[model samples]
Target chain A: MVVTIIGIGLIGGSLALSLKETGLAHHIIGVDRSPDNQRQAVALGLIDEPAQDLTEAVQRADLVVVAVPMDAMLTVLPLVLDAATDRQTVIDVGSTKALLLQAVEHHPQRSRFVAVHPMAGTEYSGPSAALPGLFRDKTLVICDAPRSAPDAVARVEAVFGRLAMRLVYMDATAHDLHTAYISHISHITSFALALTVLEKEKEDEQIFALASGGFESTVRLAKSSPDMWVPIFRQNRENVLDVLDEHIHQLQHLRELLHQENYPAVYQQIQQANLIKKILK
Target chain B: MVVTIIGIGLIGGSLALSLKETGLAHHIIGVDRSPDNQRQAVALGLIDEPAQDLTEAVQRADLVVVAVPMDAMLTVLPLVLDAATDRQTVIDVGSTKALLLQAVEHHPQRSRFVAVHPMAGTEYSGPSAALPGLFRDKTLVICDAPRSAPDAVARVEAVFGRLAMRLVYMDATAHDLHTAYISHISHITSFALALTVLEKEKEDEQIFALASGGFESTVRLAKSSPDMWVPIFRQNRENVLDVLDEHIHQLQHLRELLHQENYPAVYQQIQQANLIKKILK
Candidate 1:
């Protein structure tokens, strides 16, 4: 199969590597707006070639992977579907699904498009950050799967399966809500934590001298690209807002317990939080 | 030299392993209130023998290590110092230093006591969780060094140096304040994040099915033992509360930017947080 992947950065470049490694895609073409990324993707052998035209690339490929940032995905998804043939399958690896899925809902080749989000990433970006086995044993969410043609959905599942990802199906609305709770809120909290410590560090130069594994892990996501996250938060504004409010409320409750020197209540809350061990493991 | 390590949990047990590996302690002694811990510490070869009494352990060793939970450290540190001779050196590895240092400020053997906080740990606890080189390349904050005898401070420094740890000296008050920003606040945010997601999971069970590395890293410290954290927070309440307020303020600001559809402002804030990349690296 010939596969064309748009925006060959971390997710897209990694996906390209996986497809080639699994022998699922005999020829992989990359389409990126940045010349630097296009050159890096080709240099790193993440893609067979860099496509000069999106419509031409879509026309030639049996499968198209739209892995652009959220804002660009709105226009790119519709364009990919516009050029998609009946036999061609197009899938997006976006973080937020509701708006992107809605953008191409009334398109003529809508049934050929699949909405997917592979739940995996790191705090780095660019083609150089592309990693092998990036999606192994990770969850892959297929949003609004009922709207897509059976063959298209099956092709997406087959491709992700080859990458060793677990498939979970959900409607676009549910996908947005759940990801806000599990993924998006984590980035926000980490960014805020970095800002909090950075603010304190300004007053005392020694503040970060004592930062260890705990602080590093908790604030690691703060280094994620804003170009990627601002769009996600903007696209899923209401759900993101809802989770942010709840997170702040939880922090305030903890602060109140600490203020009262209520060690027992604090202990109970930590024990409750410890239940995550079962889910995460 | 002989070393007696009280409370053979994560910190103490790990220290025993490091000392043995570095040949700093010819004979290591373990002292814990729990019989299970004593058995496990010995079986794991963390110590050569288990001491029957705290006073006898302190008396026999040239250096004493008090690695109990912060609440136990209050009484245990003073007791260990009570048993110390002019030639003996004692150090307590507690998270919060201000209160622990104050508790033994007026002791006749005060100059024999060195208060230290090794700025390194994992979420797990106990003898089985003990690891070699846990303190390697991590910061070791030596608090109120001027109060400790010159020889006592030098001995403590030499031990941590053999474990490949960098040392930073600060007064107890500054140590508590800085740790509140870099360490204590991270745990509270993680615990609160775990509670927020867990609360949402109650309504939708599939929420965790999509959790990825980002979520896990941000919530990792939520798994830390409350037995260790509660006393640290209880002692550093005011400082923890201050950083918590700032963290909440930053989150609320980000939420407002999202609410107003201020993508530019949100992007700027994230870029600011990205400065942590320099400090952390």
Candidate 2:
């Protein structure tokens, strides 16, 4: 199938690579607003060619993958749907879903678009960061699948399945909520941790040299692009705020336990936290 | 040289492997409170044999490595020193340094002991978690090194140097304070993040299915053993509390910005956090 992937960056570029590697896409057309991204996407072989016009790209492709940032998705999804034919399937690979799904709810071509959040990515970004098997063994969340035509949903499932992703179905609200707890809040904590350590590093220049693997892993997501995350936090504002509040509360509780010299309580809390191993493993 | 490694868990076991790999120790004696650990250490070839008596082990070895948790270090360091001969060198590899250094400040054999914290570890613990080259290319902080005998310091330095660790010299107070920002705070944040997600998962079983690499890395240290962390936190209580306060403050600040829908400020904060890429890479 001929696939048009918009915004040819980390997720889009990785998707292009995966689709091509799996023989799922006969030819991949890249559609990105930035000239640099379009040039890099093609140079990196993440796409067969760069499309100059979004409408023409949508019209010509068997599959349209809207892989733009959250803010851009609000505008681009509607435009993509407008140009999509009945036979074409449109799927958006975005972090947050509620707002994007809401943006095009009443559209005549809404049935063509399937909202997907493939639970995978690295700290790096841009077309140069693209790698094959980025989605292998990772979860692919298909939000509000019933809203999309059955054939469109099946196509998305098949594509991600071929890419070796585990599929989970949820509504847009639950997708945003769960992502806040699992994905979005991790970025917020990482960004905060980096800021915290960097703030301390100014006073002790030697501290950076002491950053070990544990510190690196905890602060890794701080390297994520603001262009991708700011819009995500904005679109999923309420959910992110709720999870952030709970996260802050948990931290404060730990602080209080430590302040009281209640080592037992602190130990208990950590033991509780270790329960994540059951799920994550 | 003969080496006796007490508390043959992650650090001690790895140290045994490194020492054996470098031929720094011809014979490695394992000492641990747990029979299972002693058996595992020998079974895993982390040590040549298990020592039945601490005094005999210290007397026979050219060097004694105290790799116990923080709580054990208080009693174990003095005991090891009590048994150490003038020809023997001792080193305690624990996370916090100020308290341990203070506990042995007046010992007659104080010069025989060196305080070191190798900034390398995983969330996992125990002898089975031991791996070769765990300390390679990682920073090794030597606290209050001047207090140790010149020959003792040289021996300790040579051992870690052979393991390919970069050594940094600092006083105990500075070591504890800096680790609070660079190491301890990372663990606290990771534990808190894991707790927050697990709490949400109680209500939503499918939430964990969406956890991606980002979430896993950010919460990886949460799986750290409580037996290891509770003691470190107790010893470095004040410094950990200070850094934890600042970390929580930063989280709250980000929460406020997101709550107010200040995407520009959020963007700026993330951009600032991205400066870590410079230090981390």
- Interface RMSD for model 1 amounts to 0.8
Report the poorest 10 consecutive residues by lDDT, candidate 2 chain A.
A201-210
CAPRI category for model 2: high
Q: Where does candidate 1 chain A have its weakest 10-residue lDDT segment?
A: A97-106
Off by over 4 Å in 1: none
**Per-candidate local distance difference test:** 0.93, 0.92
The local lDDT score (0 to 100) that residue A40 gets in candidate 2 is: 91
| DockQ for each model | 0.88, 0.91
Interface RMSD of each: 0.8, 0.7
Model 2 over residues A1-281: C-alpha lDDT tens digits? 99999889899999999899889999999999999999999889999999889899999999999888889999989999999999899998999988888899999999998989899999888999998889999999999988899999988888889888999999999999999998999999999999998898888897776888998899889999999999999998999999999999999999999999999999999999999899777
Top candidate on DockQ is 2
lDDT of candidate 2 over B1-281, digit per residue (tens): 99999999999999999999989999999999999999999989999989879999999999999999999999999999999999899999899998888899999999999999999999999999998999999999998888999999999889899899999999889888889988999999999999998888779897887888999898989999999999999999999999999999999999989888888999999999999999888
